[model samples]
Target: MSTHVDDADRLARVTLSRTIEPGDLRVTGLVSELGAGKVLGYLEAAGEVENHWGFALAQELGRVDPAQVLVQAAEQGIRFIVPGDPEWPTQLGALSNTGALHDRGGEPVGLWVRGAHDLHQFAGNAVAVVGSRAATSYGTEQASELSRDLATMGHTVISGLAYGVDQAAHRGALLAGGPTIAVLPGGVDRPYPAAHAQLLDAIAERGLVVSEAPPGVGPTRTRFLARNRIVAGLAEGTVVVEGAVRSGAINTAHWTTNLHRPLMGVPGPVSSAASAGVNQLIRLGQASMVTTAQDVITDVMTHAARAATGAEQLDESFVPDPVRYPQSAGPGPAAGISASRR
Candidate 1:
């Protein structure tokens, strides 16, 4: 079912994935304007490069064997996804205009996906559950219960595949036989924590293992920060189970707010240091307080309806200029499509 053009495009993106730094919006937009093949050609044709994108990417371009990269990934049961593919999640396009965050921004040029769930489809109906890695028992309990309830409603729970809150969130969804997605900072073929190898496998069997990095790449601090946007971008809204004022969970909430999506936070004991950040978010009107699944649903639905009403009956096809985008993030989360199928 793959065309020669499709194969070439996929290969170009695969090579670019290794060369380009993750979340480089300038280059990503260039890839969007010019096709991947043209972009690769431009890089190859340049004998010496001055621009950061071309310079940085050109160095790696010589080292990359596109065909070999694709073959290796395929051998590992990993697929390279470029824009326009059936499984490509268009919602990521919103990142193009999200501006840069800590010098990281832009939709991925392509994704390295493992597992059977369809990326585009499942991403549509997803909700992100993120919190601290050093989660308290109460925090983990809330995360699990909240995700379980959301899953029972057929909403997919999406999270970074880290320890603490992220792990608990994924488990809760699985417990309810609900769909879940594990977004990783490293290669989907390799588990990060190593200890979570079994848990990651369980997620792959039922949901998906997604990443922006290519196979064989290990995670770094920058990659971890870049990974949060994907977690927030894929979902209609984000729920912070527990976050310190400076935790990654709060960082995700910032992305949720930046995306103009509904942001919800669960309150913990005021005296507890673990709850400081989320409490700040709630206090500052950065996020609404959500204690139950119904609360999250109400906030999500209400915001969706209000956004719809304010947009002059506009849909995904008509984004306001203030949003800095005209691209459709695709219809808000839908059912999951198997990764191995169309």
Candidate 2:
């Protein structure tokens, strides 16, 4: 989709947003199934000839004040880009054919995107780095260094913005002077965990924080699972830094794999409990091992560059030794890596 659209399409998208329920699969399916121009038609066919369904659905969802929600969405400078809209990401559209598309748990009829940068900029070239919330210092350092390296190479880093690996990725990308996107499990206005409020604010200001849920929706167990699909969908590949045996990060890895995106894992020592899952992924052939950002990016970016430019093959490289951080590195308050593990 192009980054420009007609005023009518934008208004229709806003109207659709007001109508859909938070995390309602039926509503999201209807939007995806019918696309933009036909959404009103489908709603009318369901009942009501005078566009009553749009306003009525808003009231039924108890969105504080139906009219107020629309007003607030507009006041915040948020714009909704539906599937057929020019700004709708082409990469996201590809998901529809794969049956692995997340579509933000069928809540968002259109993304309520804000910030100076266009949302499609993320689709330009993105990769997600996710791992356990209880990450070790080694996992955190790998995530941070990988994020920074990717950002420095003009790639947008994507993550969940949780503690541990997620936080490290965001800080690393920010430190590298690059934009990043945090796809939240709740509303854009609602940052989960509450403790990350300052960090989230910084991301929304300098980068982008996105969600499929409506403005007032809070995070939930189900919402967290749904958000992972989005992280996988938005990026060309996903890298699992460190996770526990049954971690949510594994869900994102599976989603990426199912969607035919490359799945990479940052391998850690077998002795580290935090890296056991990552090692398992490598062992099972579900993901390739990546010790550095270039290892992962080579598969996603360099091959494409080579294809486009007809360049000769290049030798593989590792991250600089001086910058390589270990899991045993003593943690300080600023680092955010778990101190207990240190």
Candidate 3:
């Protein structure tokens, strides 16, 4: 917790490296104690760590040397955000059972963040809007509009930097001149899909691009799953724009539900495959419907007011179809919308 320790960062990195491959009990025991940089320092300090559990773990699993990773990150001018640090996101720490990791056991111990933006301002009152990679034009527009409205209303917007809905959310917030944050599945330096490099750069310059992974790491299926949790954890609520039943956005919705955060979904035409997951959430009572920024703001405010007042039942009347699109008010897209619209 002390940020000024001389050798602590190096030890943290060593701990990270030693927890891999054969996995040293000594390093593993220190996992919860040391931060990422300190762990790596411990590994290097020992000098005998090459291929001894730590090296193999980094090599096989593609985990970078915590110290080396930090150096690379610093080269990119990225800051390492550790738990209990000034810049560490407090909302994420709410998942104590998950060790303050993002999402429901998906996020890592700390994040490597690159940007001049203040994540705290966004984290305290943020909403995540996520959906399918293959988004329809209508879905994209709705996502953008939702993001714009959220930003205009002073809510921080959070999302993955993936194609379709993810990209739209970031763009919308930027276009609206609102603060937004992109949670990457890989290291902040590794922009997945490679196509959104410019978008990622814009985010880092104007907002923030964050990742829990050490630097130099690339995207993997597991990392993608992990990224979703950070998206959910950073926000007070989440809105599913468009996605299939088994889509990653659905995973985020589930995480939101588990976190007791309000989950909202923008309904698409029933015939649209992208809306299937959201519609299903609505049907299952997992998420409420949200069509406009007003709906989201009202719900969030109501929840906050109730919590402050120690009320058991928060008011849900501000939204029309509380279960379907609670306060949603938008034209439904045509059925069979393509994912590319996003």
- TM-score per prediction, in order, is 0.87, 0.76, 0.77
Where does the lowest 10-residue lDDT sum fall in candidate 2? Answer: 324-333
Which digits, one per residue and each the tens of the lDDT, describe model 3 over residues 102-169? 32262245677889976776687788989999999988999998898778667788999889999999
Write the candidate numbers in order of decreasing TM-score. Answer: 1, 3, 2
Q: Give the distance in Å from residue 283's predicted Cα in candidate 1 to where it truly belongs.
A: 0.7
Error of 1 at 45 (Å): 4.6
lDDT of 2 at 133: 96
Output the number of the TM-score-best candidate.
1
At residue 341, what lDDT does model 3 achieve?
27
lDDT of 1 by residue, 86-159 (tens): 78777788877777677787788888888887887788778899998989998899899888878876678999
TM-score of 3: 0.77
Candidate 1: count of backbone clashes, pairs at least 3 residues apart or interchain = 6
Q: Count the backbone clashes (under 3 Å) in each candidate.
A: 6, 3, 32
- Runs in model 3 deviating more than 4 A are 1-68, 98-107, 314-342
